[model samples]
Target: MDRGTVGSAQSGRLLVEVREEGSSAVVTPAGELDHHTADVLREPLEDCLEKGYARLVVDCSRLEFCDSTGLNVLLGARLKAEAAGGGVHLAGMQPVVARVFEITGAEAVFTVHETLDAALAD
Candidate 1:
């Protein structure tokens, strides 16, 4: 699979990497995903959908933080993917990040996995 970076690294807040795993597009976003950096993740995710990659796995093992903005982006992606007869899976969330999903009841909305491999298996 070809690996590449998405978005400018100059922001120093987030780094998004895009790669393909099997039939799924895996997006790994590191650093803080807040209002300011949410777009960093959005663009690549949208690209995956546009490319007809309906099965998307977000490998968040390196993700340090996530706020409402980040959640919104995930939710939007989920909706879009579902409409396209695909689905978005979130994997390896940090405790703090997982807490955000739990607090907002988004855990029920998304398919959460303990590892990227597990998500890919699904």
Candidate 2:
């Protein structure tokens, strides 16, 4: 795998970078992810699944914030990936973003990794 960015999308609040690692599509979204910027992250994730990268690793170390809509976008991706025999893996989640998942019990539904490297390794 080249590890180069296969695609990317950026909005005012979010910048999403997509790359390939083995069979997993690593999507890194930096900055705030809210209702207004959810699509910036969603499109790249959906595109990864469409392109047959069923495993998704979200490197959220750079992500500073995430709202409910942002969580929904991830949940949606998880469902899509699961349907295709894959699942979403969340890695390096910041405290704020992780809090949302915790509050919503979304963490229970996905495989959460402490780091991006760990996520890809699994």
Candidate 3:
């Protein structure tokens, strides 16, 4: 149940918090997830994988905005997780962010949940 922050105040536009939940690593990213801030999310995700956590849950309840770069990061993580016999699950997406996934057909590729509890339950 260790929790840590991955983003820095000086260079990071996004704030990512990492926590362990069961066998999964939960990454909560807040603020804008654009090209400039994608690394904030990426670093924690990679760390989770390196630590042998293949099941990832991205709690997007506080995520205010997301761009194509953000989507790309998630997709790449999904690929890596799946290759490791685990997967990336998304939960609590905002309308705008959800629309981005829907428009890009990424919704079909990801397992979306209505809440963090739901994601964890699955």
Candidate 4:
């Protein structure tokens, strides 16, 4: 995956960073997320689910854009997380990134928080 550390992926357009906070795994994808960069985010999310850390928190404060491929990655992660008796939480979405969710009704499927701290608290 060319990651500098475990559970992280970085490319020219995207950087997906993963960290554990309590029982939750917080994945922060910073930069554009499109067809080319989707796997950078997808792999770690699936890794967390496979490891049984089903409570996934996506810190999207730094994310700038998301295309259908990127959205699909998240939706897939959410379903897997739920199947494991946990769920995906999205926090700190920028207006551009949040609009994609709002228009596609993806936001309703996720627990949206205004900040990363709120997501962690929940």
Candidate 5:
């Protein structure tokens, strides 16, 4: 894989990293998040909910791509969390991914932050 290219930093595929900070949960998703890797986000998100985390932050700083499938996963997670009286924040979206949200009119539905710290603070 070529260095500095998209999705090359961690095996040219999606990598979801989850951690807990106080009562909040952080899930940092890196790499492509099209149909093939949408499920990569599901488990960690579900785990956070199962662990009773009411505050969730999804750090998208390293995410290289996202398709409709990826968007669906995010939407589902958002609904599930909000239904449970919790909410999810999207952090550090790349331009391409952010455009997808904009095109789909999902930007208004999510609480998007420019950084993980900002998301966590909210």
Candidate 6:
């Protein structure tokens, strides 16, 4: 497993953990994600996509905050996965994070689930 810390402002913190599971790559993000941390997500995510993983799951249950930058990274990841004949799913989004997606009209764009288990089941 590899971990990268992103945001560290007084607002919150963000850490992204990357791990492999069979043919898929899982990115577990813990903490707040804003403009400062969005790029941190893009790097690893694009790396996994380029590695030919068939599925990408971003676990956000532990995420306490997010901004448009974070959302852009997610949408970008989804696009990358689709371009590679793969899929991107979001799991375990906290209420605030979920609300960001909804307010931005991204809830309809992402296959978001309440838990990692549910996302994996799909």
Candidate topping lDDT: 2
- Provide the overall lDDT of each model, using Cα atoms, as 2-decimal numbers: 0.89, 0.93, 0.89, 0.92, 0.81, 0.78
Candidate 2's residue-wise lDDT over 25-119, tens digit each? Answer: 89999999999999999999999999999899999999999989999999999999999999999999988888989999999999999999898
lDDT score of model 6?
0.78
What's the candidate order when arranged by decreasing TM-score? 2, 4, 1, 3, 5, 6
Candidate 2 Cα misplacement greater than 4 A, ranges: none
Candidate 2: Cα lDDT at 38: 96
| TM-scores, all models, native as reference | 0.92, 0.97, 0.91, 0.94, 0.88, 0.85
Per-residue lDDT over 1-122 for candidate 5, one digit per residue giving the tens place of the 0 to 100 score: 11121111123488887777666777888889888787778877887788787667788998889999989998888988898898889999999989999999998999999988788777
lDDT of 3 by residue, 18-81 (tens): 8888788899888889999988888888888988989999999989999999999999999999
Maximum-TM-score candidate: 2
- 2 or 5, greater by lDDT: 2
lDDT leaderboard ranking: 2, 4, 1, 3, 5, 6
Q: Counting only residues 3 or more apart in sequence or on different chains, how many pairs clash (N, Cα, C under 3 Å) in candidate 5? A: 0
Candidate 6, residues 17-50: lDDT per residue as tens digits?
7777556677887877889877667777887877
The alpha-carbon root-mean-square deviation between model 4 and the true structure, to one decimal in Å, is 4.0
Which pairs clash in the backbone of model 5? none
- Residue 55 CA displacement from its true place in model 2, Å: 0.4
- C-alpha displacement of 95 in model 2, angstroms? 1.0
Candidate RMSDs in order:
2.2, 0.8, 2.3, 4.0, 6.9, 4.4
